[model samples]
Target chain A: MTASVTSLVNQPYKYGFVTDIESDTIPAGLSEDVIRLISAKKNEPDFMLEFRLKAYRQWLKMDEPTWAEVGYAKIDYQKIVYYSAPKQQKKLNSLDEVDPTLLETFEKLGIPLSEQKRLSNVAVDAIFDSVSVATTFREQLFEVGVIFCSISEAMREYPELIQKYLGSVVPVGDNFFAALNAAVFTDGSFVYIPKGVACPMELSTYFRINNGDSGQFERTLIVAEEGSSVSYLEGCTAPMFDTNQLHAAVVELVALDHADIKYSTVQNWYAGDANGKGGIYNFVTKRGLCQGVNSKISWTQVETGSAITWKYPSCVLVGDNSVGEFYSVALTNNMQQADTGTKMVHVGKNTRSTIISKGISAGKSENSYRGLVKIGPKADGARNYSQCDSMLIGDTAGANTFPYIQVQNNTARVEHEASTSKIGEDQLFFFRQRGISAEDAISMMISGFCKDVFSQLPMEFAVEADRLLALKLEGSVG
Target chain B: MISENSPIILSVNNLTANVNGTQILKGMNLEIKAGEIHAIMGPNGSGKSTFSKVLAGHPAYDVTGGEVQFLGQNLLELEPEDRARSGVFLAFQYPLEIPGVSNLDFLRVAYNSRQKHQGLEELDAFDFDELVQQKLDIVKMDAAFLNRSVNEGFSGGEKKRNEILQMALLEPKLGILDETDSGLDIDALKIVADGVNQLSNPDNATLMITHYQRLLNYVVPDYVHVMANGRIIRSGTKDLALELEARGYDWVLDEAAAGVA
Candidate 1:
């Protein structure tokens, strides 16, 4: 079993093929001038440039956080290109106007960018390297008053909405990674569901980083207004590189009175080789604010890649009788390390939150779930329930759970449960005795272990996540 | 009921095995023909369970020196899953609890594996549901058990019954019940015994590794063997079980020791 798991963990990254296209890349470095250059290249307004400048100044003073349970060498910011975009002849007016090589790259990544070839119900905003390549279903979304486009495009077209809500949920200098992302972020999806309007279709964004030396810093903002609801999906992948790439993304979400926002992510960045030579350093900050009475926000994520992952998608329940939920499945294999969970803060009366996290570690990997649940003094009758489960495939892998709960109100209730289990020989033997192969048995067990979290994902995303897990853990057992 | 020309289903000779460097099966020998029900009764640590596991090709047990044949194929050379696909089933004494994997899906996978092995048409989900529902009747299990995770929260008797349900689904040529009667109540034992009896036929065989003679009253074995120190010390008809029950295994051990001396 160990041999098979070793072999499986050594499986090459499937999405590691780099697209050979002419790119307009800035020199590798971080300075005030670099930030200004990025903003100027985007033709941004003065306010946007000021936002980047302030964030860049704040980032320079903040120190890199080492509290996460992941180990990696210090990253040299001076060696990473902050901006890299594919060279294009002109601004795309239609899918045909887009570079065919770029479109083919998306096709190879299993994301059909063309309208006729795309999934009908899903509106996709494809972001490659440092720019939004194409966005489908714009007309349909516009008719419903649902503004879904790239953040860079939103800055130029809907600056009022961007200015009002941008950094409102996650302000500049919120954290080290968020600060850096705010300064250098080139493009990400922007979603706005109008008041009393429930979006008719699921909105999705696919992010890809093709340049090896460039860092991807995309900022996503989603807002669901009063009595409105929307479900947004995000997916990411990066090419394999011998040098670790930096990805510091920031996502903010806001839900108003009686509104609901469900954000799901399927991140499949290229993890380093078996020996941990190179991979993506994914440090992300995501937060949602339940801003009005009876509002709700939920975050569901399936993280299966990245050499080092440090993320916690959190929710702040500030509205009366609001609700927050976080469901996540983080799998680490072959020298990968992940420290991920969620935080729920209850500041309103009768607010409630639920957290379910499943972590699977195989092939000398380390996985940890770190979560916090805090109930404020005014959060009377607040409630929280959390369950963190970990599964280790081999003897050398590791799993840890650190759950912090604080309740300042006497009427608040908090409950947490944690369990650690190993995929022992007995379990595999039982499956084999029933004529099931070792790989199939392991996959079945893993799927079972993560079913609770997977159930919270969108239908198509759930299916895709399941297949990705199977592919990731292929031949992972004897 | 064995016919005159009954074919041999399983044959073991000098089956020596070990687990964690400790020799468990010194030189066990056993044989079973189609249409026969054989029971091996032994004391604890007598390697009765180890013998059954070795036959199923469990990875933990190292076959130091042995030869096993099942349906004219070299069983020892096959992987555990291949051994299972080749019509050999070992009903575990403690069935594993696989949380979140529906029993229905588990059964379908096992059933289809055997079907694919035998070159039979695999059943789809709809057809499999129909087929598994019919087989569930053999053990008198509730249909609700099919949707729950495989034995995740089942009672002792329910887990044993679920094992039988799996057996009924796979329809193996040689079924080895490893202490399946243990932890079962009188009623559960009767239900389980009845299920086994119903599944038994002229073209297949049953091998029951047990410690009690009480189970034999319901599913009568044609032959009973007394095992000690990893090898069968005496072989006889069903009366041997009653005698051993009345006189205890010490008598058989002393008699065998005296004979060997």
Candidate 2:
């Protein structure tokens, strides 16, 4: 059974097929001229250009940090194309005007871009390469005073909102990847929920990287105003390539007084081959801020792909009586490595935060959970609870947990719990003695291990996350 | 009790097994027939638990030489799960604690796997819930235990009862209880023995591996076999257990060695 598990994890990447289409790609390299050309290609306003230039200069001065517990070959920034997009009709009036090939690509990826064809109550913005090809349910969202569009389109139509909230939570020079994303991000979803109006549907964005050797740097910003609420979803996939591809994305979310924002992500980027030959290097920075009284921000993510993943989706509780939550499940198989978790910073009195992370390692992969919980001096009545659990499938796999707690307030309450477990021979024998197949036994055990985190996701996303985890861990135990 | 017409349920011959390259079972042999309860009593390090695990096809035990026949088929050829689906159940001496998997779900899966093996329609959740609730009574277990993780945080007696509950649910043709009475108090032992007694029928057989003769007092065995050094060295009627209990295992081992000489 262990041999079969090793073979199963070595199965070829399913989403490795490249779509043949004409792509207008910029020259390989990063410079002031490259950033300017990308900004000009998007036809952005002067302030947007200024923001990009500033971010570029900061990125040039920064160095990639090697603090994460992951190893990889050094990335040559000069050999990467900063921007690449499929050549299609410049302005698509409707799904009918979308190129047939592009629509077929989305269809093949199991994403329905057509409003009438979508079955779930989800509005999808399909971003291929560096541009948003189509967005569904725009009229329904626009009717309710909700602004959901591509960030570039938002810059053109709603510049004031973009200028007001963009980078307000996660600054442009926050980190190495965030700075890079800020400098050269092509396009991503922008969402603005108006005051006192709950978004009628779940908003989602599906990102796909098709052009080989092109780095995908997309920026997503969500702003929930007073008394407004919205739940957003993000999913990504990339085609196969012999050369490693770079993906650095930055996502910022803000919630105002009495508002709430729930963000969930199912990341299934192309993990390299079983031998760790080629795959996406996912370096993402996602953060949310509860900026007003009684506001809430929650993040739920299931990360199962990418050859090397270094991300930490965090929450900043700046509002009194606010709440912050982070639930995550990170699974790595074969040669994959993941160093992902969350940070909760409490700056408001009586603020509360909860963090639950589950990491499963199979084959020879390494999975780690690094988290931090900080209570400011003035936050006298703050509280935080955290639990991090790791499960190793085989003897070759590894799991690690690193939790940092800093409390400056004497009255604050903070608790952290961690455990490490292995899917040993006894557990499998017990299951097999009851007639469960090896694969089913592993899947059942993993699902049970991750039940806490999976429960935090929305209904549809929870189901998908369960299925995705099962698929990834198929034949991973004896 | 060993009637000439009784059918054989399990037959083991010259079974030699090793664990981590260390010989644990040296030419062990035993035979069990339908409707008969057999007790195998031995001292520590006698490979009693290893015998049960080998029968259950545990992967850690390497079978150097063995021939096991269950219901006239080569049991050694089947996978562990297939052995289970074919009505061979080994109530573990140490039941695993699998957290997050609810007892109800685990029982349902085990039950449905057997049902599917028999080419029977799998039971849905509602129907399985009803069936499992009825089976839970055999062990006198609370319905509330069904909601918790499988044997997680359960007391020693509760875990033993849970093993019986699974046996009651699966209704295996051959049930082997390995040291099920090891940690149970007298009252718990009586309850577990009663559960086993209620499940035993003319079509099924039970094999009890125990260190004490006290358990045999509650659920009397038809035959008693004394094992030593990984092999059964003596076999007799139920009276043999009482005699051995009074005299201790040393005299039996000495007698077996004298007989061999």
Candidate 3:
């Protein structure tokens, strides 16, 4: 229910145009029957099938996490459909050989799988609902000794790689969502850049939720060999629904000696209607690994959507001389609740990390920044600096910051700072006196609040993020 | 005809206001007319800024008593924005900064608010820019200043000059400059005073509130009033400013205390 441009305040659902899609969706329920059906339908190997069953058994024995700041009853696994796929799509030989309807669907989602300039060097894995749409550039990547394709395809073609790294960082029993994802992950990207060979262009995986009522469960894994570097971008969205949609995905990244990886996420899920109904629940587990000396990883995200968001893209520095950095801006409006941040664990000597999070809340929404930095006993010379700022626009909105630090090593240095302030009425009056309306003034004020993080985005994305924030935050203030 | 005895185009009778249950101004009253320049000099905590705050109808300040009649209408009844819309301007002592809101955008809103109040057609962005550029000349501010956030990161002098520029754009009937010259150097003081002088006309009145008489040497008030402890203790002509400057406020303090005795 997108509002007309003339009146941005009153419109309803953000991504409401349901595709005239025909999907093969199984009945709701998560049990041995559903797990076997998913594996049988995908024609998985014996070990893959066993992995799913083991994960399902582990999930049943585990209880739901009770520690998150979010408030919601335990989700009923019996009420969720584990798999759904585009009805007409079939396996194809080339990009052009893929279904035109499938390609058109992604194009409408603002993703281009075959753009001449960008597609030449990059690989594309388009996950439409619970199935991979068309993963192009895989043949070229394979020639260069790289592994780039859907996780399902990777499980079929390069099972050894998947067996080695899958569920290593976030195990099958890491958390409730992670366990569920491990049991029945429908589709996600799998990337492995070979030794000493940097991926020539950014590798991206686009996840589109087209089948209604079915929660999207995807799993992503990335590994970089020694002396190699790769930058990955993950983008996700969903069709609108009257009832809330659920998305619980798990992502893990592993880097070897002297390897580096930068993961950037631009999440634009449908944030439900302004009244806070029918948007997607974006819950994800993303983490990186520094397995060898001098490895580095950075996470940058601009979160502007989601009715309820619970995600923390984090990093674990297990290598000496490793580094991690996180920069994020989360905006919530009109019943949108976002409890997102990062966690950095320093287990190596001479490790450093920095986190800068900015949260803006408006229209009775709640935006919180929850982050942690823990240094281990041998993490001597470890350093961390975290600054979280919260800006509340209207009286009814809320903003909070919770930063947890555990420094066991006296040689480790850590610092955290937080401040919360409401947009002053005098500031609004001052702008109004100059000719800016209440809405435009609010936009200006928020832009200023987010300027620091906005400047950190890539050039094209920085401009896009700025304009998108302005559009989403329209009428965000009185 | 503009009444000379009614030298003030505006008059306030026993205005009282409070903020969050704490009274700041008690029965404040003053009068000003066209062609007259009045100086309202007062010691600290004497309801100087409170008078300006009340006139502008700051929501934080609640007027609990009396009334203010501006251009022959009840002023206290108007909202702060409406007060500004109806030719009443307050040059705040401490101008607030709104980061990321450009000076130009803020000025356009002020211009349109006044226009909309009178049911007049508002100007487009280009036309509004042209209108503001003309008034910026009165303050002698730089063209580049329009791109910066309102009062954000501006020097003390720039903030005051921006306030004066706003006054010129609104062209109010009764202008209240609250401690306008507090932080200005000699050169900045001359420039600010010169700007106020250029915008003054016989059809409008200016009430300058300050702690010192130094601003008078530039704008040259026709009448001066000494206020202390919430009331005006003495009134005199321009020479009174010089007398007060030579012999500080304690002389008026002795006379006021004796009168009370």
Instruction: Give DockQ per model, in order.
Output: 0.73, 0.84, 0.29
Give me the displacement of residue B242 in model 1, in angstroms. 3.8
Evaluated with DockQ, which candidate comes out highest?
A: 2
Candidate 2 predicts chain B with a TM-score of 0.98
Candidate 3 - CAPRI tier? acceptable
Off by over 4 Å in 1: A5-10, A476-478, B124-127, B246-261
Between candidates 1 and 3, which one is better according to lDDT? 1
What is the TM-score of candidate 1? 0.94
lDDT of 1: 0.92
lDDT per residue as tens, model 2, A9-119? 444556778999999998899998998999999999989989989988998899999999999999999999999999987887888788889888998888977666774
lDDT of each: 0.92, 0.91, 0.81
User: How many steric clashes does model 1 contain?
Assistant: 0
On DockQ, the stronger of 1 and 3 is: 1
Top TM-score hit? 2
| Alpha-carbon shift of residue A87 in model 3 (angstroms) | 1.4
Cα lDDT tens digits, model 3, B53-172, are 778766567888887888888987765667778888888888887765678877877788788887998999999989888988898899899999778889999999999999898888
Q: Give, for candidate 3 chain A, the lowest lDDT window spanning 10 residues.
A: A1-10
Off by over 4 Å in 3: A1-13, A97-101, A114-123, A136-146, A475-478, B1-90, B97-176, B179-219, B223-261
For residues A232-265, write the lDDT of model 3, one tens digit per residue.
Answer: 8877777777677789999999989999998877
